[model samples]
Target: MTTPLVEMLDIDKSFPGVRALSRACFELLPGEVHALMGENGAGKSTLMKILSGVYTRDGGTVKLDGKPVEITSPRQALDAGISIIHQELALMRDLTVAQNIFIGREPRRFGILDEAALNRDARAIFAQMNLKLEPTVRVETLTIAKQQMVEIAKALSYRSRVLIMDEPTAALNDAEIAELFAIINQLKSEGVGIVYISHKMDEIKRISDRVTVMRDGEYVGTVPAADTPIDTIISMMVGRTLSNETAAITDTSRNPVALEVRNLRRGRDIRDVSFELRRGEILGFAGLMGAGRTEVARAIFGADRREGGEIWVGGKRVGISSPQDAVAAGIGYLSEDRKLFGLATGLDVRNNIALASLARFTRAAGVLDDAGMHQAAEKYIRQLSIKTPSDTQEARLLSGGNQQKVVIAKWLLRDCDILIFDEPTRGIDVGAKSEIYRLLNQLAADGKAIIVISSELPEILRLSHRIAVMCEGRLTGILPGGASQEEIMRLATLREPAMEVRHAG
Candidate 1:
């Protein structure tokens, strides 16, 4: 039997209030793609961080080529032929491709930067990858797919034999994904081992040779990817079988219009977008990336100033110049980048939950009623099934799903009648996604109008009463629930005038 490229055994790691990993183990063979599958807090990333030398493991035995070695820093790991490409690319956008790739290890002649040698070295790496990218072009000028290729090229520049990719396709379109897969195949043929960390199920089946499952900081099991069913793998990762049923298309046509937008416009981001969201309905916004779905949401929520548009709340035309005004009109927006715009990570869960409704807990003497805030937080934590040790726990300590639930709790506490959830389950796992879907359904059933903007077509099909498709900042068409993926894609790519805007009677 050939020696394994990497082997980890009995990995244990802990933080201030969390045991991130416990007796976790993983292995990768040369020329193999091993997938690390788990939920948000399942310790997959922590284990990988230890391997990449970003964090020192409390206890573990790691072997490369059947010999144990201690890797305590990223530099050490790089020297040992290991490299990590994070989901958020780390390239310097202002620098040229060659400069960004060889930033620290630039070729220098008598202490002067050797620009010619640097570009030559970068071009050599690109040629090895069969990638076509100008070494002199600024990193910012390239598309995300190209930037990702640059990241991969940087990894190979280190002559790395083991590469770890975390959610590499999260931001990539289908064509870009195909391109990335081709590169992965080429690398595999070169006897390089890869540890692919992704929540996307289909991707695991398509690219990985083996699957390792982790749950709640412990190793669950590992199985051959081609032999194991997706549902079985999901069950292993989440410890239960999640319902695969699509949501029943509820007839909300008779419901009153809770919100309406007429000619909503933002510089090229949004173009004369018009739609009416009825009470007790989930209106899904679907499009390719940069189709202006988020732009329309931001304009409606007053997070961005609209150049021209009319917004009506409860049949009354309202001037919403700022988020405060939108909030006053009973509108709440859950931003796609929740950590940046939704929750204060450093604050306790209780305070974060009550952030939007702080006034409700304020006393006449200008003092905050802490007990009232705690009670409200506790109520929603239970109502939303947020898994936290207590309401006083720091928001950042919770898993991605729990953090999202906290954001929802905040808006619910604010008593907003119209909700805009942008990418509600972007980074969440399968189990958490089911929970969020249930919550959104319950919210809509309770008469709160909802607009969900998602890059995923399945999510839109699963939850929306009406699927609204967009293309190039235009509302191209609205299809009924259960519409085929082909129909949605056609509208998503269509640039011409949309099919007649249909309003529910």
Candidate 2:
């Protein structure tokens, strides 16, 4: 048998208070696409980081081409023919594409930079990848898909033998994904070993030769992608067969409308959009990336200004000019980027939860009532099953799922009945996803109106009582709960031409 191109054995990594990886193992062969599969926080990324020299493993052995070598830094790893493209692009946006690709190693002569040589070299790399891009084009001017291609080009410029891509398709559309797959195939044909990491099941089955599952920082197993069923792979990742059974159908039509938006218009992103959230109903907003689901949610929550729209709450129209006004009107929004918008990471859990409702715990002299704040925080911490060492623990110390719960707890403390959760379970593990789903269901049963915006079709189908499908900033259609994926996708891709034809008739 040919020697594996890359091998990792008994890898272990740890951070303060967290053992991120334990005895993790992986192997990749030339001309094969090996997929690393796991839930969030399952140590897949940690193991990859160790291999790419982003993090030093406490204990492990890495072999490349039948030879063992120590990679102490990213530069060493790159010099040793390994390159990693992180989920988040690390390019300097202000620089040109050629400059970004040849950064830190620009061709020079007598202390003078060789601009012509740099562009010529970058253009050659682009041509090798069958990409049509101008080397002199500024990186900031390119679309996200184009930027991602640039990242791949940068990796190839190193003449890397082993390439690692993390969540390469998370933000791409169908056409863009097809283009990316073409590049992957080209690399595979050239005998470059590729390690692909993603959470999308269909993509794994389509692109990978083998799939390796990890659970709680431990290697679960590796199997041929063709032989392992997706359900089986998921079971291995989470240690249980997650039920595909949809939530029981509940009749919420009789419930009064808790919130309503009519003809919401916001430049080009939101146009003539309308939706209603009834008490005791989970109204799901479903669409592809940039399909205006988030825009509609933000407009309703007053996080973004709407040029023309009317919002009604509890059978009366209300003016919400800002987030504060929305909160005062009993509406709460959990942003998709929670670290930036939702919580104060530096503050303790108790303080974050009480931040929105501080007035409730303040005395007449304007002093904060610590006892009252702690009591309220503790009540919700237990009520929501938030796993925190204590209320005094910093919010940033908690896991992704726990941090999300803290956000939910904060809004609940504000006595808000209308909640909008955008990508609520993103970056959370499978176990924590189940918990968040249960919590959402419970909140709906308790008569709170809920709106969930998700890119994942399964999530939209499972949690929504009614799914609202958007396309190009318009409400194209609404489907009953448990609708098939095909139906939802059809509506999600519906365009203005179809609507115009129907209206013309």
Candidate 3:
């Protein structure tokens, strides 16, 4: 048998008050795409971090090509032929693609920076990857899919034997994902091992050779991706069989309109967009990336300035010039980037939950009521099944799903009836995703209106009472919840015509 390209045996990792990984083992052979599967907080990322030198392991034996080695830093790991593309991209957006790629290890001639050499080298790498990206383009100007490609290109430039990709397709559209898979196939043909980490089961079945399952910080089992069923893999990860069926949609046509927007226009991204969300309904916003679904959500939540629009809530017109106004009008927004917009990472869970409605927890003497805040936070923690150690736990320490629950708890505590959830289950695992789906259904049953903006068509079809399709910043069409994926795709790609035609009188 050929020697494994990378082997991590009996890996153990811990953080303050949390044992992230224990007795975890993983192996990858040259040219094989090995998938790491687990629920959120199940130690998949922790194990990968240890291998990539982002975290030092408490106990483990790391072997490369039949020899044992200690990788203590990211630089050491890279030098030892291992590269990791993190889930959160790490690029200098202000710099050009070439500058960002060859950041620290730039080729210098005669003690001066070599800009020409840098661009040339980056262009060569892009060409090798079959990517049509200009090295001179600024990183910030690229779409998320393009940025992700750049990250992959940067990792490949290291000429490493092993590459670890964490949810690489989370931000990409279907076409982009297909392109990325082609790139992966090319790399595999070169005999480069890849550790693929993703919550997407279909992608795993399509791309991975073998699958390793982890549960609650321990390795459960390993199986062949082609042989094992997706349900079996999910059962191993979460210790239970998760249903693949969509949530049952309840009729909400009799319910009053909780929120309505008319003639909403914001630059070119949102052109004369309008939608009405009824109480106890989940209005799903579906589109391809850059379809302006998120832009419409942001405009409704008052996160962005709108040129022209009329917003009505509960049969009354409301002026929402900012997030504060939206909140005051009983609206809440859980942004896609939770760390940046949803939660205050430095603060504890209790504080984050209470942040939106701090006035409610304030005493008559104008002093903050710590006990009241904790009580409310604890109530929602159990209510949402947040899975945190305590209300005092920092929001950053929680898993992606748990952090998302914290954000939801914040909005729920504020008593907001209209909630906008943007990419709610983007990075969470299947088990957590099911839980969130259940939560959204429960919220709708409780008479709260929800607007879910998601790039995944399945999610839109599953949760929506009515699916709203957007194409190039316009509301192309709205379909019933039973709309087919083909129909949604057709509506999603429907672009506006250049000019309106009129019959000559």
Candidate 4:
């Protein structure tokens, strides 16, 4: 039998009020990609954190090359050939790529910073990875994909034999994802062991060698990624089967037009985009990165200035030049970066849910109606099936799925007839994704117009009543529900003005 590269046995961890991990265990062999999968709060991250020394394990035996080792801090873990790249990249935007690669341990000569040595080392690493990034370029100048590569290079700088990557491709486009996969293959060839953590089942099937399933802070089982069916793996993760059914395409042509945009323009980010969203419909916006889907959403929500456009709400052309104006016009936008725009992370769930309609909860002399706010918060919390101890729990304490629910509840309370959800399930788990899908369909059934913007083509296909594709900031074409993925990709890649923008009912 081959000696395992890493062995974590009987790991246990706990926070102030929650048991994060319980008797969890994992193993990794050299040159293998092991996928760690679970829903939010399922202890996958906790287990990895223990391995990477971000959190000290309460009870566990960590072995390297069959020899027990104690890892008490991140520095010790790095010295032990372990490193982790989190979902949120930790590179300094103002620093150069080379500088970011060797941040604290820069090459020094005669008490002076050795820029030449730093660049030379970074260049060598990029060459080894077959990447064409400039070492001298500022980190902020690079795209999210390039920044992720920089993070990988930084991990390699530590001579890390064990690398833990969390949701590495959450923000990457197809081309970028392919490039990252190539780098992973190169690393595997060099005898590195990778712990790949992501909620994307397709990616797991493609890149992982073995899949380990965790649920509610306990180990479930491990299976061969290539041989195992995705549905089986999902069942292992969530302890139940989730429906993979596509959205039922209902006829909403007779419904009133809830939102209409004509000739919307905002530089090259958005160009002459037009669409009509009817009540009781879910219109999905599908496109590649930089295709202006989110840009169009922001323009319509008045988050960004539109050079030229007309926005009509409920048969009236509404002047929306700001988010406040959009909200007053019965439009609500849930941004892709929910923490940055949608929710006040520091506030409790009750306050965050009532944020959009605070006036309704306010009384004489600006006194808040605490009872009403609590009742409203509890109502949505129960209706949305949000898993939380109480409405008083801090928003930051909730998982990504619950945070998204809070944002939705906020808009629902605000009584917005038109809701534009940008990447609503970006970082959520498979089970949470199902819940979000069900909620969206329920909202549409209740006569709410919704616009869903997603990079994943399957998601667009799964929930869209009618799919709208964009290319280079222009509306390429709109396909009916149940359109083939190939059909959507063709329009997504069409750079020229080939098809006139129209809603295909």
Query: What order do candidates take by TM-score, descending?
Result: 3, 4, 1, 2
Evaluated with lDDT, which candidate comes out highest? 4
Clashing pairs in 1: none
| Per-residue accuracy of model 1 over 370-488 as CA lDDT, tens digit each | 99999999999898888777899999778766788899899999989999999888767788888789888888878899999887888999999999888999988888888889988
What local distance difference test score does each model get?
Answer: 0.89, 0.86, 0.89, 0.90
Write candidate 4's Cα lDDT for 429-505 as tens digits: 99989988998988898999999999998899999999999999999898888889998999899986455535566
**Candidate 4: worst 10 consecutive residues by lDDT?**
496-505
Candidate 4: segments with Cα more than 4 A from true spot: none
Winner by TM-score: 3
Please give, for residues 1-505, the per-residue lDDT of candidate 3 as tens digits: 9999988899988888888888899999999999998988898888988888888999979999989988889999999989999887788999999988888999999999999999999999988877889999999999878999999889988999999999999888888798889989989999999999999999999999999999999999999999999889988999976766564666666789999899899998998887788988998888889999888888888899999989999989999999999999999999988987998999999999999989988888889999999999999999888878799999988987789989988998888999999999988999989988888888888999999999888899999988888889888887777778997888788895222210000
Kindly indicate the candidate among 3 and 4 with the higher lDDT: 4
List TM-score per model, in order: 0.91, 0.85, 0.95, 0.95
Residue 169, model 4, lDDT: 87
Off by over 4 Å in 3: 243-247, 364-366, 497-505
Residue 37, model 4, lDDT? 94
> In angstroms, how far off is 35's CA in candidate 1?
0.8
* lDDT tens per residue, model 2, 119-192: 99999998887788999999999866688889988998998889999887755667778878998998899999
